[model samples]
Target chain A: MPQQKLESVEDLAAKAKALRRDVLLQVYKAQSGHPGGSLSWIDIGVALYYHEMAVFPEDPANPARDRFVLSKGHACPAQYALLADQGFFPKAWLETFRQYPTKLQGHAENHYTPGVEVTTGSLGQGLPQAVGIALGLKVQKAAQRVYCVIGDGESQEGVIWEAAMAAPHHKLDNLCVFHDLNGLQIDGDVKKVMNINPVPDKWRAFGWAVKEIDGHDFTQILEALAWARTVKGQPAMICARTVKGKGVSFMENQAGWHGVAPKTEDYEKALAELAD
Target chain B: MAGMETAGVGGKVGVVMDSLRDAYGDTLVELGNEGANIVVFDADLAGSTRTSKFAKAFPDRFFNMGAAEQGMVAAAAGASTTGVVPFVSTFAMFATGRAYEFVRQAVGVGHQNVKIVATHAGLTVGEDGGTHQCLEDLALMRMIPGMTVLSPADALETKQAIRAAYAHKGPVYVRLTRDKFPRIHAEDYRFQIGKAVMMRPGTDVLLVGCGLGTSICLAAADLLAAEGIEATVLHCPTIKLFDRETLLRLAKAHRAVVTCEEHQAHGGLGGVVAELLSEAHPMPLRRVGVQDQFGQSGKPEKLLEAYGVTPQAVAAAAKAAL
Candidate 1:
């Protein structure tokens, strides 16, 4: 197959809206899952898997394929939708979400699911693994890139910065990290719980190419990812400004929905709001 | 006699590095020479963890993750996902205690082919005190599903365990000590995963030990023999996939059993043995390990003695149980 070109910003935005609807439907069906962060990361997930990355679902174990790690794995609904849409597995697998022995687990498992890359749920660990993949590719002189998405609250972990420092020191140019700066976590506002302010400057100080963009904007997301590809000497960090629940009005910026699954009425409202 | 013959074939003789951490680095460097896809990683303690030697020789393959044990483990998992065998080195305390979640998710849960080689295990870390020393790593790591836990008795066994871990196609945690101890294994004794080594065979009592405690068990067996009491010493290196058949046979053959290790009695070697014996073949078992207590700053030998991990303790426990 010929190299797939980047989709138009409007098309990608529409896809994000569709993904949000799918996420709400799946979460509602599962009767258990985090919907707030899932909605927040919909656009970012679409941009990476559909536009920014060079992975082929036909061969998920392709050594040259770009790696995408869902560090904030509680938002697995976003990943499940992206994987199904990308043809990693059958779209019908999404319906099996949270069911025992199903590949579509509440948290991602690389063994059962294709294209999931690294198994993650424990917060603040995906970036380190991403760094390792980038480092490994560099060592092998392979052209594969590694993209990791983490939540703003997950940034409270010291290991993330530890990996941040090591990535640039090793000159992992194939690494691009996106922080879902949704400003909310399970407890409440991230600022009230543990301030991860100056996120961009902190990453820049650690020797990364820092970019702050509207995570909901496909055009900006595309431009930032394209810029990251051009940079050759350092890792890139994109502080993606996002709402906790971007598509659904009632759940937007709400901390209660961080880990709580939406009820039938809430799910209907969320799906209706996300319908394009 | 068979163990001696295997030791001869492997060239397992004489003063090997008493510390398993040093053996890990040296063996990794040796394994790198054999054209294997071996990679080394450390969480900023390359020198302290003794992986600096491998890092110095193969800088391209060695990654210093800088005080991030979780990241180191996760990266190792990622590397393994790509078919590269990665040996992740860190302090046992941090690797097992702090990065437990990462290891469980990325390596254990994923069943990735990553080797976690941890140093400063048990009370061997000494003066750095309880904060640095990890006397409960074996218990924590063993609890992870599909994790192969190997705590080699000495340097030679450590080298062999590293090779075995590399050969094994799954997640393996090789716990190592910081302090130097006597190299006990004969040079050619083959180290096999999940297989217990019957160091000395007798019928009166069975002394099962792992890691540093194995050496103490050997000493206790010798002491028992000197007192005209026949004792058997079994070296149980693999805590996860332990040799159940051999353990049951030894339990039936011996009059009583004594388990020893430099770890918390709660979930360490003793707990495992006790659980096994409770179901397989019940026996009067005495446990000689750290008894629900924390360690303190002192010389490693002093700490071992104070914690009742010495051969005298094992001998006493064996006698009482008998």
Candidate 2:
């Protein structure tokens, strides 16, 4: 597939909106999914899959291509749409999300889905897996890099810290982690549930080169990813401040929207709000 | 049968004892030397688990995921997706018990080619008491979807089992013990997945066993032989894909069956054999093992004795079954 000319932030913003609508549609169609977290990382996912990451639809498993693992797997709708729109699979499968015999599982399964690199729904696991792949890629002497996107709520898991320490300790410069700090989690605010505050200092103390950015801004997302690509000895952790439900008005910052699909009337209102 | 006369018995344990962990490490080195794709992960038990041998030989391929078994398992799953055979190792207690769901979801459900060489398994992980000992590792691992569980009886089988796991694609749990076990197989012995090794021939009772208990069963066969009761000792290395055909033939040929292991009587080799026999061939049988009890701090040999995983105990079970 020929690489498209670099899309401006306006173009990325449009793609992210489409991706958000797709996530809402997927969840509403399936009657179940994690919409809040999925909506949290749309622009970031777009920046990676669209412009920054060296990936192609024809060569999904490109040996030298960048690998992406959604460690916060419940937010798979963002990735599922990105892969489909990128032509890795079919866009029609979006409607089939969470339905039986669909490649779009409740959570992404690596073997079942074409573009998904690892199977994850169980949180706090994908970071370690990404570290392993980065280490493996480093051993292969490949220029390929790994981009791992996890959630702040997911950071509360102990193994994520284990992986946070491991990647930098192994000197995995080829790996970059994106922590979507979407404050809200199930049962209310993440700070009140299990505070993973001081997220940047935490990664820095664990030896990661930290970068903070507005997750909704594709330009900032791309800039951090570009900077992350150049760092040679230590892994990069880009902490992106994001909203729980960025596009939809009713769902934004509400823990109830974390896993619930919007009702029909609310869904129509969300679609109209995103039309702006 | 050919090496029977020279294969001395009577609780002597003089059949050229070798450490299973050592063979596992040596086999890993051989596997690593053959290709650059073999990546090894150890959860800070490099010395105890003997994965340190692989770590030292292939430093680039080795990952010491320090004292984090859950992280190690998930990382192994991640590495396997990139076409590298990831061999994750830790004590069985931590690997299977502590990091079970990670193994189940990441490796088993994900269908990753991760070889889990968990050492220091069963009651033989002595002096550390019940916390370190993992008698239920086999049972827990066998239940994982598409998991291949192999508990080799001795060093020779351990090496072969490691190679077998590497050749096969999917999640595997190759259980290894801490202390050395008496060699029950010849040096020329080859391992067959899901097949039992007929260590000794008998006609009265079939003494089915695995891990170190196979050697104990061999010794028990000798004890039963002296008392005019011939017992066939079948060493089942692979507990999950157990050799059902061989078990049925031997069970029918004998008067009764007696299953033995250095594990819980409810869910180890005894449970597997009993479940099989009751449906297929319901006859009088005895399950000899650590009768639903946890192990305590003691010598490995003494723990085995206290747990009743001995030739004398197996012989008594065989007699009672008969």
Candidate 3:
């Protein structure tokens, strides 16, 4: 049987809300995961993994399969939830988040996990690796694409721009960089700590086809990604405007949830809000 | 396998390039023909590091990562994650020193199968002087956990080393020199990662060497042989995976040992040998390498001679150790 393709924005929006709810429930159970960035990236992850990207659940290591790298690895709860939902692993394994000897480590490990394309936690480094994968795929004349999602806070790393400069120079149209412009990092708001505003312009200056979109809006993300797929001669960057801690009312735009999992009471309240 | 046989014979008859950097490019092209999985990466020194041949043969597999050594190493690590065995080439100084942190975390800690092929190591980089010549790369790379270190003696040895490195698992650093030297090893001489090659056997004194120093030690062995002073020459190529049994046997047979390398005496092959011998068998030892001082602009041979890294210096060090 053929896989059911995602058709409308409403279907994608409903899927994003369901995944966001799962993200909150998992983080609440783990009591030691990042809820904010995961919540903020729900729609984008859903659109990419469910709608836009072409992947095979049974043959995750298929040479022709598209690649996705989570450069900002702290937001792994969303990635884990999405992969689990996609049947990369058992959904029951999601209960063992951050547990000993589990394939799901605090950060993704490509060696152990099936779906993760690269193991990344260090900021600014994953983009180059993504570039390498895309370059390698191109060399093999494979039709697969590479997508790399990074944090706005992580844009401060010099290596990011170094990679960015090479992507367009090589004419890597198969590569797409998603800057999760969630405005907040560990210490405080990303703008106050170090301004990465003019984000799309920065990527544009580095030679990528730039697109800005409301991160939580499913229609905007789908359109941006579809347009990125059509672009040629250079890589594309989707500067996704997002709210840190997007789903729950109390956690929305809150910097404290950047790396913290909620308490039991906080988790229940967060789940209730996300469900509604 | 045909390329392997050619490389094996080529190194002995001097048909191969004189320098390891040159051989790196040639060998990469051969490896590319042998297998499609081998990819080459450079930090904008395609010609300097001599990987242009591979670039020409496999343009799509070749990535000139600009002047960003750190990003190159990290990306190489990432490529390795995808199951493509990537050989990242750059100057020894930049590949190890400038990108130490990234190599450490991404390759070493991540346990990626990325080969860091570095050229222009030690004083042999000549008039480019201290800035380009990396005398401390071995020390720095050997310190990293799970890093396999190889310093080949000549161009032939470099080909053998590259083949062996590909077969080996995990991260590897293959150190190459910029200057040309004599081909000492004969054809069919197999190179292994952990085992040291016993070049010449003697009982009185053991001369331990690596890289260009290995060839110098072999020459010194002939010099000492002419003088009726029996000397043993051991080519300790893989510094990280030093042969403990061979070293112990050499130490037991020869009362004193003389260590040679084109690097700082501190934390190099000498330091590694000293630490091993000091713990197991206390033997009188003398080191022949660059002292704790910077190199000056001069010819490569003059620099080696001035730094007391000559055949005569090895003979003198052997006498002194005795």
- The lDDT of each candidate is 0.85, 0.87, 0.83
Instruction: Please give the range of 10 consecutive residues that has the lowest summed lDDT in model 1 chain B.
Output: B1-10
The collision pairs in model 3 are none
Using lDDT as the yardstick, the better of models 1 and 2 is: 2
Give the candidates in order of DockQ, highest first.
2, 1, 3
- Which tens-of-lDDT digit does each residue in A1-276 have in candidate 2? 543435788888888898788888899999999999999988898888878888878778878678999999999998998888888887899999999988899998888888888888899878998998888888778788899899998989999988988998899999999999999888899999988989999999999999999998888898998899888899999999999999898888888999999889999999998884
Q: Taking the tens digit of each residue's C-alpha lDDT, what string does model 3 give over B46-151?
A: 9988999999998878888899998888888877856789999999999999988778767876788999999888987888987887999999999998999998
Q: Per-candidate DockQ versus the true complex?
A: 0.72, 0.75, 0.41
Candidate 2: tens digits of C-alpha lDDT, residues B1-322: 1122222222343557678999999999999888737889998889998989998888888889898889889999988988888999999989999999889888888899999999999887888999999989888988898998898977889999999999988888999988777787887898989999798887899999898778778888988899999999999999888899999988999898988888887787888899999999999899888888888998777777778888888899999989
lDDT of 1 by residue, A122-142 (tens): 887688888878877777788
Every model's TM-score: 0.94, 0.96, 0.89
Candidate 3 global CA lDDT score: 0.83
Best by TM-score: 2
Writing each residue's lDDT as its tens digit, candidate 1 over B1-322 gives 1221111211234534366777888999999888888889898899998899998999899988777777788888887766689999889999998989888888888889999989888886889998888988999998998999998988888889999999998999999877766677888888999999999989899999998777788778877888888999998999989988899988998889999888997697898999999998888999998898889998777777788888888889999999
Model 2 chain A weakest lDDT span, ten residues long: A1-10
In model 2, the clashing pairs are none
